[model samples]
Target chain A: MSNFDVIAMALKNLFKRKLRTFLTILGVIIGTASIVVMISLGLALNKNFDSQISQISDITLIHVVGVDQISSQSQGSKNKIKMDDSAVYNFKQIENVESVSPIINLSYAIKAISGKYSATLNLVGIDAQFLETLGYELESGRFLNDDDKLNIVCGGQVPYSFAKNTKRRFYFYDPNQQEKAPDIDVMKDRITISVDMDYGNIDTTGEKSTTSTAKAHPVKFVGVLKYDDFSYSPSDYNCYMTIEQVKKLKAEKQKFDKSSANNNSGFYSDNNSDGYNEIDIKCKDINSVKDIAEKVKDMGYNAYYAGEYLESMRSTAANMQALLGAIGAVSLFVAAIGIANTMVMSVYERTREIGIMKVIGASIYDIKKLFLVESSTIGFLGGIIGALFSLLISYLLNTTNISFFNNDSYIYMSSAAQKPLVSLVPLWLCIAAVVFSGLVGLLSGYFPARRATKLSALTAIKSE
Target chain B: MKNIIELSAIKKIYKMGSEKIVALNNINLNFEQNKIYCILGTSGSGKSTLLNLIAGLEKPSAGQILFKNMHIENFNEEQLAEFRKKYIGFVFQSYNLFPTMTALENVSLPLVFSRVPKKIRIKRAREMLKNVGLENRINHKPSQMSGGQQQRVSIARAFVNNPQVIFADEPTGNLDTKTTFEMMDLITGIARKNNQTLIIVTHDLEISDYADTIIHIRDGVVDEIKNKE
Candidate 1:
């Protein structure tokens, strides 16, 4: 018979027993929905984890620390590696390296005085041009520019350090009173940075001594940083200045220290003769971070990047998805068994009908095709309904904040500023669900269809 | 007249546990084209078994059964299905109409198996039903019609494919006397009009009167052969 005729007949037979067909198809629908929802939830978790990690630090940025002592394989001897301007230039030449900045840490004892309020703060020097590429988002004013060498930007919480006078101490561990913005505006007020030669000194009696002499340097506040919940780096509590400006301040401090009776050696002297203590390198893409980091380590420097953590996070997400998929697969396997059972029952009930068909010149292939078409139609119909149901569940999960589990148990809990979209169903997944269910139906009907074809016309016709 | 089917030394055996029962024993017969023939026999006389062997529904154990000189016993199941589709039609005592299908659909089944297009097959089925006086009942299902009408629909189905031969096994066995005579007249008239070979198996002697040739079977073998013309 024509394929169209066979399909029509199969449909007619299925419709003959509507309730049974519907029940079988319902099993498939539940199977498909379970799988799709499970996979979609896994994808949503992965996306949330990625966004949280991205907010903390740039995955492509690698921190390079100079090795104090390294074993030189070529010379068969030990040597020291310095992270200097030359190292920055070498890193810039590395493939996929976008930008490199040498970090010069200044240990000058300095305090910022605005009107009567003053505070002691840490300081770090960085390249003014590469500040934007380093992913530092400014809060108020523009970032450091090459032309503004003397300008400085205060951290978001730096303003909270100023009190009524210089003797007023600030404690970071105090949690009773939240720090408020100081009355003195660093952006508008005339701020002077004073360096103390005898800062942190003690007498023979072990009593704290005030600075005997100090020099003040006038400076401009160009910008302030935005507060980051996850950032505990110096940028959160210290100040940033151009490398040239810090170099000049260091030279002045050295001159003043040499003229004093108390000739205390500087802490920055070890790498001061050649280069800075560290360098930060930015890669063009996250995928290239590992390769560039390895190259920097091969040059006898210590490299640390977030790529390793991100890699582990990705693998964990994939494993969770696979586990969820297996759970879904078990449901679909049960649905397939339902289909096979239904088809076998149909064949048993239609034995006489099948015999009549055989007597009327219907081929064994036609008999098999008819049963296969019936079962597959059930599968395809179930898949469509199941996909639609999954989409509805996904939409509800994304829009609603109904939390069934402990909030802290979720990986995306840190990024709780917005409600998490916990389920995501992509287009490819919908299509695959439909096609896979259909294949399951075909496989389930195989044995039943074969049995229908092998039925004896003589015995079957005689059967009631 | 040319022989449409020939059975030479054909045997059919059935095994019930360790006991052996011979259904047909060394039977030799020839059915001519464009002629009405009947195998008259009582129950368990092998008349139906002989008809089944001739239709390629069963295989012979010791001899050859040929349709137009082709050994039908050697044909595989698939080949037999093809043979039945192209050259044979069957009418059963139970009518065997698919209750879910309409009268027109029931009649058009053989044409469907032959791969005839829908429009043409429906048109031919309508014409054949009209010839059997079932034109008005084309849309009625088998359950909706009487036994006589159901048998008429079955007859229309048998002749709708325009096969070379038609087999009827107790076609009127479930009908009353008047309906039986009506069914016999309709079947024989159609077979004559189409010039097709007709083979009917019945236990009733009155039903054998309509056939041009009669082969009386007894004890798994042919007892006698009689011709009217």
Candidate 2:
């Protein structure tokens, strides 16, 4: 028989039994919704995680550290050791090595004196080139220029604390955004101090030593940094300075030590000509930072990053998303069961109708198609409803201030000022949810259609 | 006149718990075109069984049943459906009208299955409904109509296909005497007007008057044939 005839009859039959038909369709709707929602949730989680990971550090970054000479000696000479400046230079030559910077720890307190305000703040010195080696967005003023002499910049908290004691305001436009005014200014206004020695004991004896106040230079308040809640604190913080200033301080301390006949505070080298205690080497690009770090480690010094401090902070969100997706998929499986049940009932209720169609010259193919169409339609409707529901949920979650980010467990390096948290659904993900739900309907409907076609006409017609 | 339905030594056997009971015993029968015939029997006498066998709804246990020289007994289920659609019309005792459909739609079903155009199918179905005097009740579903009206709609469905043979299995069985005669007259009148072979299986002796020939069956065997001059 013609396809229209069977479809018309089946539809009419279904309409006659409205409750049964609706119930069957409901099963498919639930199934489709479950599948779509499950997958959508999973995808949303994955997306959140990926963005979080990218925020902390690009996945392609490779960390390189200097092979510890002290450890190598203790472990015996079996391990080859060739880590040196040449290795750092070689890493820079690598194809994908975008940028590299060497990190060193030196804690020193700074004593600043303006007309009325004066305070001591501990600071780690990072070179101007080191800023370029990492993904750092300047808030207000420009980044440290190559020609900057004795220039200084500080993290988000530093300016907040420093400006409290000083008359000059720190202003820097947040580089993470656009159209906002400059808020941080670290140029010619904030003063930073350096000690003659790196955490060395100050001599109590001798000519009016460190106990006596020394002259403090006025540093510019060029810019302010946007808060990264995942990283560094403002109270005791790192500061950017020219390598020449650190060398000058070391030389002055050595001269004072020699004159006093005391060897206690004269710990480090005297000049930039004698090589720096820390060197912040930068590569041409950020992509090669990890490779260059590896090379730097091979040279015998520790390579560090501001990015590594925020690693867990970024990755935790991604992990949460993955977990969410996995949880959502379980609901879809239940939906599939609903669809199956509906289809089975439909087959049962329409046995006589199917038999009649067969008697009226309906082909087996036609019978199979009719059932499949009905099932597919049910699934498709379910998917649409599910998608709408999911969209609403997503919208609510986004609009609500439900904080899924920023916690005490997040490892905040000395760099972060505020926690990072946001959720966004991509277009492709929405489309995929729709298409996947449709596919679920088709697959779930297939078995019932086959079963309906295989039913014997004699028996089906005889069914009461 | 050519015989439209022919049965040669057709046997129908029923197996009841390993015991084979012969329902129709080597019955050989021929039905001529343009005539009304009734198979008269009590329940389980195999008269309805013979009708089913002739309609290709059931296959014989032995021997061949032929329709216009084609061996219908040898036809498979699907082939039999095609054969029925093309040449045979059925009128069941309970007037098996699709309950959801109106009288016109019910009558149009066979033609619809025939792949006839919608306009043509509807027109022919309306005409057939008119012939059965159900033109006014064309839009009424089976459940909304009386037994006589439903039976008339059934007769229209059978005739709408313009089949060569019409098989009625106790068309008046479920109707009252008044409606029974009305149904029989409408069915026989339509079949005769179309010059089609009408086969009726019934227990009512009064209904036999509408037939030109009657085969009285007893105990799954044909006892006698009566011609009403």
Candidate 3:
């Protein structure tokens, strides 16, 4: 008989016992839904970990620090790998390296001031041309260009960087606007930058006394970055300037008066030439972080990235998925048994019909295909319904009222762009669930279909 | 007329716990094309067993049943099924139709196994049902039909495929006397019109009166052969 005829007959047979077929399909639905939902929870956990890691550090960035900074670990290693212009150039030559910029962090020796307001400064000096590639987002103004001389990009916290205004605080998502707004507008105002630590001392300035003076230069305002609770970009809470401008500021400080500038800036430890103290390397993608970091470590510089944490977190999620999936498979196993039992009962009930078909020239292959098609159709229906049901359940569980996965790491994704997830059913998981249930049906129906094919036409005809 | 089926020295034995009961022994027969043959025997006289053997439903222990120069007894189950599909049709004593299928579906079943397209097979089955005077009961299932009407549906099914050979094992076994005569006439008439071989196994002498040849069997062996034409 033709396959089309066999399928038509199989569907008719399934339709003959609607209640039994429905019950069998219900078992498979529960099985598939349980598996899909379980894996979705594990996927949510993976997403949560990724969100948390992204808050503290970019997974693709490798921070290269000079050996002098790692004095605790490498006491005598003469490895001359400095975090300088040469090291930055060599890192850019590495495969998969997207961009490299040398950086220097100065927290104490730098100060910025408006007419009557003094601001405490954490200044970061880097290549001005690489500002855009470094993932800095602007709140008001533009990034520093290559032609900028004394321009500086202020941090997102520039409003609260007052020197002694200890009572004032800044909240990123402040709702009650009753708190006194800062009088300083960094983006529109010009600021004077001084390399002297004692530039703003009132007592020494009141008497014009013996503190060696360095003139503060007027720096132009460029960009002010927007705050991102989930990002660790370099310009988040610091001012960015070109490395050449900061170096020139230091030179001017020394030329004006050698005493205060030569005092204790900690910009150097006397064991090295003039080079940058830090280099930030941006990789093309997350997968290249570990390899590039390892190569930098071989060059005797300290390389740090969050790729190791990402690996452990991902493996943990995968293990959870396996455990949960196996637990759900037990129910599916029971459903398979239900399918087998239903098919076996159908075989016995239709023994006489099978005999009629055989004597009427229907082949044994046709008989087998008929039963198999019936069971698989049940599975296909159950699988599709079950996968969709899993999505609904996941959404309900992840809702704010349930808050099933409300945890520390998930707080950032609750923003408008994305929601915090407790359960996540991806597309491929649904496809896998459907295909797996069909295979289960095919397997369960195998023996019963075999028994149907082995039925003797004469005896079966005589049976009833 | 030419012999379409030849059976020689056929033997069928049943084993019941080390006891061998011989159902048929030394049976030799030839069925000619375009002729009706009747094998008459009392109950338990191996008439039905002979019909089953010649129909390729049962294999004999020692025999050569030849059809178109091929040994039917030596053919495997699959080959026998293929051979049956190509050349054989059956009208059972109980009118074994699928209880769920309608009269038209029952008649078209043979054509379905022959892989005839749906449109052509339905058309052929409808025509065959019309010939058996079941044109109005085409949609009625076997359970909804009377014994005579069900038997007519079975006859239509047998002739729908137009096979080379038709076997009827007590075709009217459950019918009244008038219905039995009518079923026999309808089946024999279709077989003769198609120039096909018809073999009927029954004990009723009245039913054998419609046959072209009659063979009487006693015990496992043939007692006499008589040609009425």
Candidate 3: which docking quality band? acceptable
- Inter-residue clash pairs, candidate 1: none
lDDT tens per residue, model 2, A1-464 = 46676567656655666785676556545554444444454454445444455555545445454456675576567754443345446656666655544333233334443323333343334455656455566655755665666565555555434322332322232435333422333454445443422221223442323443334455664544455644433322456555455445545544555664434332233233233344444545555566666655655556565344444534654575566665555655566566667778878977987777665555566677777666555556666666666566656655665545434433233124332333444566556666666676677778988898788765676687
Question: What DockQ score does model 3 reach against the true complex?
Answer: 0.48
Please state the CAPRI-style docking class of candidate 1: medium
After superposition, the stretches of candidate 3 with alpha carbons farther than 4 Å from their true spots are A36-60, A65-132, A142-151, A160-183, A190-220, A226-234, A241-278, A283-288, A299-302, A327-333, A387-407, A413-417, A421-440, B203-206, B216-219, B223-229
CAPRI-style docking class of model 2 based on DockQ: acceptable
Q: DockQ numbers for every candidate?
A: 0.64, 0.45, 0.48
lDDT per residue as tens, model 1, B1-229: 8998988999999889999999989899998999999999999999999988888888888799889999989998888888988899899999989999999999999888889999999999999999999889999999999999999999999899998999999999999999999999999999999999999999999999999999999989999999997
TM-score of model 3's chain A? 0.75
Residues A1-464, model 3: lDDT tens digits = 78888788888888889999999999999999998998899898888777767766667888887753565245454544556777888899899999998876664356666765666566777888677786667888898887889888877766556544221222243333225655777766667877665455455235421364767788887888887644434455677888888777656645544554446443332233366767888999988889999888777777788777778978988898899989889989999999999999999999988887787787787788888999898888889999999989988888854554456445543444456678999999999999999989888999999999898777787888
TM-scores of the models, in the order given: 0.83, 0.78, 0.80
TM-score of chain B of each: 0.99, 0.98, 0.98
Candidate 1, residue A51: the lDDT equals 69
